[model samples]
Target chain A: MSLGEFELIGRYFRSMELGNAGGSEHVTLGIGDDAALISMAPDKQLVVSTDTVVLGTHFPPDYIPANLAYRALAAAVSDLAAMGARPLSFTLALTLPEVDETWLQSFAQGLTDAARDHRISLIGGDTTRGPLNINVTVLGEVRPRNVVRRGDAQPGDLLCVGGPLGDGGGGLAVVLGESMPSSVSDAARDYLFQRFWRPLAQCELGLELAGVASAGLDVSDGLIADARHLAEASGVALHIRLADLPCSAALQAWPEAQRMEWMLGGGDDYVLLFTLPVASIRCLEVWASQGFDVTVIGEAVVGSGIWLDDGQELKEKVQPAGYQHFQRKSND
Target chain B: MSLGEFELIGRYFRSMELGNAGGSEHVTLGIGDDAALISMAPDKQLVVSTDTVVLGTHFPPDYIPANLAYRALAAAVSDLAAMGARPLSFTLALTLPEVDETWLQSFAQGLTDAARDHRISLIGGDTTRGPLNINVTVLGEVRPRNVVRRGDAQPGDLLCVGGPLGDGGGGLAVVLGESMPSSVSDAARDYLFQRFWRPLAQCELGLELAGVASAGLDVSDGLIADARHLAEASGVALHIRLADLPCSAALQAWPEAQRMEWMLGGGDDYVLLFTLPVASIRCLEVWASQGFDVTVIGEAVVGSGIWLDDGQELKEKVQPAGYQHFQRKSND
Candidate 1:
């Protein structure tokens, strides 16, 4: 059955009682009012970020609602994670052509699960009738001194990734009708699909790297384009080794040349790319023990842009074109 | 020239430096980063609200970009005003089919004007290529005890409005090609057009009524529908007098029956409708001297639901329908 705006919000969005995870203290009031009220602790600074995902542009037209919700929320939360912020709460503004009860239920469930995982509440939002679009604004908290920024990367700092990448790109390719490698196992294929559907924002790793990392940001619009951003922001050159690029077993099963394209230029891999001093990396060994696969991939140098390498030979400079919204095509 | 997402944001949105006011104390970081950082004082609670306006649905397809931005921001900020919250910061997510430089300039100017008026900074946001849509998320602050809510109206409380209503409705009629009333003065027509183009949020008045008002909400979806919401939330009946509905001379230029319909059920007024004890309203007399036309219009009763009156005769119950987004039709 189709639901009206009020009933849809009440039946699906409002029932995600996130207060159970000790998060209600942050929310003085939630949905069903003009606005939601929240409180920030004296010692914490609030981090705010917003992201928009439009159907047919951001994903395929027939995408599942649940996965769309999860991916959109994850993408927004990734910005907060880059700032070393812990999730506090989020608001979603959704524009839909029509209300499908089953779709709403699935989307709400995915949003609920994601919010619960990050210990944040869906405090307030608005739903309107239009073409399908989701805009999420996430509020997070970080200690003032521990906030990480992209402009603080130092020359000689080692570049590291919080985890593997390119699985999401591979899955996207498959979803767009590109056949998966026959050699890829069923479990690996499933892993890639899950990675595409539910990208894990590196919040925990970011929090751990708070005061430790020199600079950081989540990989969204391809590694090469994002690396150029970091280099420009930090006033340094980032040199990456293609051999050191991290990938999953599923990605490795793909054609060798195609794997490089996905790993270097593909978008939507929400893993954290950060910089740390060589000595500091050794001191931050606890993350590995905690099951985080922090891998050193490159280093920052005293220069301007981004340079690529294939272990033996220094490759050509990578283009800075990323997944820009208005640009017709950007390496994605 | 058409602009890319980054160029558009950099040229138009980033230059609004709201930190010039006393507000910068709450913002540890502003735009141009992964996330914007904000801090709230220990004594204040944060209030958050979000709203979305899409082309052709919220406004006409050929709406001017500047007025669209202004009205959209005003509508969103009205929610914060309803909660008696002071503006802190805001995030905007805009989706556009194409980037028109002239449109962006006008929209940015309107956004800057509004942000300057409210002294709130544009913290962080996203821009995407899609059908034209604008989503704004506002953050504001209020003292813990002084927070105004919807369910706190007492049986003996007096209902009041911050200012006149229905001018926006009249203006909207003109915008939709309903010929202006033949008797309407040129000045009155201009006033109505201005009201529709730039609805004001009664933030100052709401802040003044912080601890004084028992319950409150901004009149967006007309007085009838919104008052019903208040009554349902407070578990008390609200009796509104038709003759007492504060309206502008511009609205009076329309037909008597049309004016009443617009006053009772028209949307986009963005004025505060609040309830307070009879005695507490007297303490608010100073606001009138300060140029706020605070007028008493109704009272809360012991029972539930809403009742309508025309001074001596009881009028038919006003239908509790307004400009609901997903509903097929309302007054708008």
Candidate 2:
């Protein structure tokens, strides 16, 4: 039951309805072409973002192709979440050295399942032979003027997080075969692994907090780096109480400095780091009543530099911060 | 002499002044963060597209990194051209085994130059260490109702081309070192080589033909495969005269079958294929009046199928068309 390119597309890719996000009635044409064209909501605007995950860099060589498909879409869609936008449509351009039916089936399942869950439709893209890579370009819907941005933080706004950090970052060590403490229980292991392996984009949270939050960004590099972006963009300062930094139970047994290292510098945390008025804490609680939780980590202050609870005046974190490819020097 | 990712991006990618297209005014936030956001045009819709080019698949390995960058951007931009859209922004996700300063500079230069020409800003994207691959996503602007699709070809429309074809296909053979004819004089060699190396995207013609052409698409795969798509989508028959296939003068000395193969099945021909009414042909002469050359290659008839002159059928050309990665069945 092997299929060539056309047949493979016909059998697995085309049959799946990709543009059913209640916007299909508006889509003149969907997939199966050189490109796709669709209209945005009449009252809303369109938001677009793209992310590419390359094998061995974004994931280990032994990473499952199926999960790769899912994670690639997740990482790209997370940008829309950071902007307080609703998932709409995505185009996937996947490259491979060769094709394997089983691998294709699993990969397609991940790609389509995520699309369905997010109410997005497959649009248009290209396929070619090369090293394995998945680039997902996603289009989302946002209110005409309610989208949040990194530059909107105010002096009195409290800095908050959508969930626990360092899970994805710490989980990478496990993937790379680095040994850590045993207090990171098996339940903690599964929790962090799932966080690292299949991160759920906080689209709902983003939209919910759109008007309430002054500034926001997805934590991909690390807490320190992303926190700095928010501060720099808003022309304010961020003061993170080191003791308030959220961590999974996995870090309880590690030395304080090492645990702080993972919490501060471990990249891959896709959680949303944002700032809002202290009054919004009640609104956030109401959001948590709806099943989405948020943690208050610190606050935006009337200052010019980032700070830690230890009173360590952090003038600079690092230049050209975070996970970079063309930086000439590797972050890790 | 040493520059980091931020400095590299500032010196090259951000050099494009997106203010020409009005995207800069709407960029609530630009590059240098989790993602960049652009405000949707008030009256026009947003068009998004993604394309991937592998080292040995789209371009020969010997192709310089800069040209490869320019060529990939050109290929993707051709899609927006088919839709008659205004270029807005692009995201480049580059994957490589290792960061080569020379390669990065050249690739960035090509991308920077192309973007400057079209005023397409480089938005935010990922950079990862892995196999060499580039995935580019482009967003463009179009009137809410003016998009052209393959499904819009009319039964009695005149099938027209934006420009000459087969030049790119023949150019690829030279790049691949598979077929270099001695008869193709040295004077024309550079033209053919450049054509194959950096084929232009028909964005201007596409935007100009929005209301003039009935349907449209770019020739990434061969003409036959794409023509079949146009015929099937429109539910009409396309009748192309085999003797009427266009070619560059350098390729004129090639054998008839070789010429046909290049014209029909040679992928990477980024020319725009479109349909217009015989009555509308006179109107398109406005392009010629504007100093742009247009070619008429075929006509659409009532029925579903694409045929060549001499009464040959498309099925006779082979349905397992174009070059697939698995065509070579490489296990590695």
Candidate 3:
């Protein structure tokens, strides 16, 4: 049966209990009128980020709808985490070639699960008929002084990552049917696939490191590539110790060179990469003790560009070989 | 030369003087970061809305880039206007099939013009490779008590419109090469085309009507259809006088039947439709004197659905025949 826009929304999205709909302190209005009304704490500032994921480009055309929805939201919310902002609400502007009720149902379920995981409400959205694309604009709040910026890292600051790298890339390979060696177990494959489909946003870690991290951003692009952004923004050089880069067991199962490539150049990790003063190392340890998985991978120095130290020698410069959208091969 | 996503954004969108960059009280941080930071007055509530306009569906494939961008932003910002909120900032998530530098430049120029006209900043955005789609999320601020809701119109409230109707539909017809009668002058055609390309959002009027309007919304989806939404929300019947609809002279140049159809069933007008207490007629007149063209169309009554009064007889029922995304014929 063909569903009109309102009926489709009413049947799947509007009826779902995604939180903060009827009686929310901050969300005065949600998902019914022309706009959504929200109120933040007196001392808080609003933070917003938008991300778009397209079929065939961001994911395989046949990818599961639920997982695609979850990943789309996770990627958008990761920006909020990068800003050290508390997730409040998000609006999804979804375009579909056709309305498949079953696909929409699964997508909505996944979106609801993601919303619950991120502790954010679905405030308002627009659905249109077009190529399959999901654009999520996430709203968050943070105390002005506590917010982290990408351009504040000073020389002699320690560079850190919130989680392991390369799992996302490895998972993508697995999803694309890359043949694994006999050493790769089912558990490892499952772990990597989970990482690809449900890369967690480091919200709690970001909030905790608000005053500690001098410069920060989420690693949507590859670690080495995204690190250059921080370095350029802060006008400092990042010296990354190649051996110190964190890797999940699933990623480590691959060849050392492949794992290293993924570690340095895999995109969609959604891990927070940040810079903190040497004096804040103690705070990092404290955060680690409190269940925040942070790994010190490098240092910021008074220079330019990214330098790779492989324990023996320091590589002069590194290229940002992350996934560039328009530069990629056409899906056609 | 093919442009990477970052390079394309930096070359066109980022460098544009769309407003509220470098130094703005509300926009603490604009583009180039993970998210945008905005702070509003303590007494104001935040209003937000998202809209997605897709190529081949919302606009023709060969539509001018600048006009398309302007119209997209205007449509999204119109939601803020409908909520009686002051425009602040917006984020754009644009998906394109390919990177065309010339098209990008033109689109950016149009977007810049729209942002300047609306007095809103392009704080953040995302660019991805996909079918052409523009999703804009707009944020605004309004005093809590002054906000107009769709569910608050009393039975005796007078229904009013902020501006002329049917011009948008008439303009769309012009754009689609609809042959007008010989009597339709060139000036009228030019006016209609302009109306289609640059439908102004009644933001100032919405803000002015905040306390005066009991209930309100923008007329995006035809008059009778959208009026039904207001009626349903208010739990009252809207009795609209067909002859009382404010139509532009350009639209009036069409045949009477065609003009009536366009007036009753045209979409994308982006004008404000509201209900006010009879005691506020003086306020309406005062607003009219100040260049806010508001016309009283009918009244709300204790019933359900929409009742049309054509001066001769009252039509008991009317079907909503607005533009619906998925239900329409496939572009394929």
Candidate 4:
């Protein structure tokens, strides 16, 4: 209860083992120093991203520490994945209300699991006393030529998503104790919960799409909202077919209207959404054959904004809608 | 009052100008994407540090947003100075309770001034809604051979400080409305306040000290406490001559006892504390001639803890004491 900052950091963070990647070769000096020193590969450029999650705003007040930790790190690392970068290291700036050893232990465990899964090293961090807030700054590397950007989508590019959508939103509904139809099975509920709590970064798929995909980003701000960003950035229009949007079996248990809303407007799926030329369809086949759940649910056109095409003959222009941190009361 | 996150970021952060350094050549992509891309020089290793300041904990709740922004960044960047790294870029993770355009404008102005002064570019950041917290992750680079470390001190190495100490604590007192003696002029009070609010990182001195100083760190954790860290890290003892410790003229106006306590135990004086070999004293003279206030204050010894000599036969071992975030009720 009366832990010093140094002791808390030493016990919970510094001594923790890194994931499968172990210590990074780039690390010259790590935790306990004024700054961490990292050596870089000569041919690689660094990719960096920062993400902050706050209690009550980013997650429910009573969320599990371990799950929150895992989700936070994974969500941050997903940026690197979106950019086709390999994980290198991350620093955590954690502000907590009090010194709770149990919470710290669980949080550390969750971080360890996430780090291992992501193959990144924990280089350094700052621990402070305040409201519960976690800021993760992830550093990664990619060859300059292999790096992907949002502003390179060609007009005729095929718009694709790495995997299923709507699961994260559905999972959030389950977490919030929203009433599920009596027909929704316990296994489906469990699946949705897992999707919400442990959304994996599509790193491998992103890497494969590096030179192949014209432009890409992770589906964090819902399929339609995020696609609009890519469209605007690349000066093209995105046409997404409602029938082609992939949904997990768990999410499919919901009504068609609810599933469509979650798929198009709900956020936090962490799957890669990208654009590739028609020639790269073979690559998609290769990926699909290799057990990747990549699906082409849209296309890039010469116009602007986003369009939704139902199975019917009608096509409607849709406004971008997703979780905007300041606009919304709370966010994922 | 109801600004979206993107609009807020675009208005305040993305459009800010860099200091005299202008935009960094290392930046390939900045601000708009999922991640910022930075190309690094092959021969130089990267150095990074993260620091967080929370409202009510790190500063008074009613603290000015601009001053807080400037102070937060300067303090964080001081770590790069401590490591003798050249400024490159930084990312800010900011959480606020509400969208106050007036507060944001002032804060952004402060950040702009600090960025320009430090010659670092803002690459990317995250804006979230929550209790006020600012987390800055700074990235810099240094050649492999020119790097300094805390665990490299040698016995008989002369201990030196970059400049005067205790002004920060004295200034904090001024900020907190502490009563000052009539003998302390308004000029002295102003000087103290500036020291607390705008402590410059001794970056030029730190860069010069690389390879010259056997070991070093910025004195943010008080003189005696920080010396203990250097001593322990290097497996040596540090002996300080009480008479030799430097105090700012403003701080000297206080009673000798209070001045000594602040000089010995006060935090947030971002001056470089380092150990130099006796053979390197000429370098110190060169630095002094160049207007650096470098001063020898002690020597590293063969023992294992910090010892204080009051210019007499009696030498007493001193316990390390400084602000620890978790242990203390509030911290700077």
Query: Residues A74-141, candidate 3, lDDT per residue (tens digit)?
Result: 88989999999999998888888778889998999888878878888888888877788888999999
DockQ of each: 0.56, 0.42, 0.56, 0.60
**Of candidates 4 and 2, the better by lDDT:** 4
When 2 and 3 are scored with TM-score, the better candidate is 3
Estimate how well candidate 4 is docked, as a DockQ score: 0.60
Candidates' C-alpha lDDT = 0.79, 0.73, 0.81, 0.82
TM-scores for all candidates?
0.93, 0.88, 0.94, 0.94
Candidate 1: the clashing residue pairs are none
| Candidate 4 or 1, higher lDDT | 4
Error of 1 at B187 (Å): 1.3
Distance from true position, residue A221, model 2, in Å? 1.2
**Residue pairs in collision within model 3:** none
Worst 10 residues of 2 chain A by lDDT: A323-332
Give TM-scores of chain A for all candidates: 0.91, 0.89, 0.92, 0.93
Order of candidate numbers by DockQ, starting with the best:
4, 3, 1, 2
For model 2 the TM-score comes to: 0.88
* True lDDT of residue A8, candidate 3: 73
- Candidate 1 global Cα RMSD: 3.3
CA lDDT, candidate 1, residue B224:
71
Taking the tens digit of each residue's C-alpha lDDT, what string does model 1 give over A1-332? 12345565666887885532536678889998899998889888889999988865336667788888888888888888899999888998988877778888889988877776677788888887778888999999999999999999999999988878777678787666567668988787778778888888999898988988989888887676677668878998898987899988778888877777778767678888889977786645788789888888899998876777733322233233332221322211
- List fnat per candidate, in order: 0.68, 0.50, 0.72, 0.70
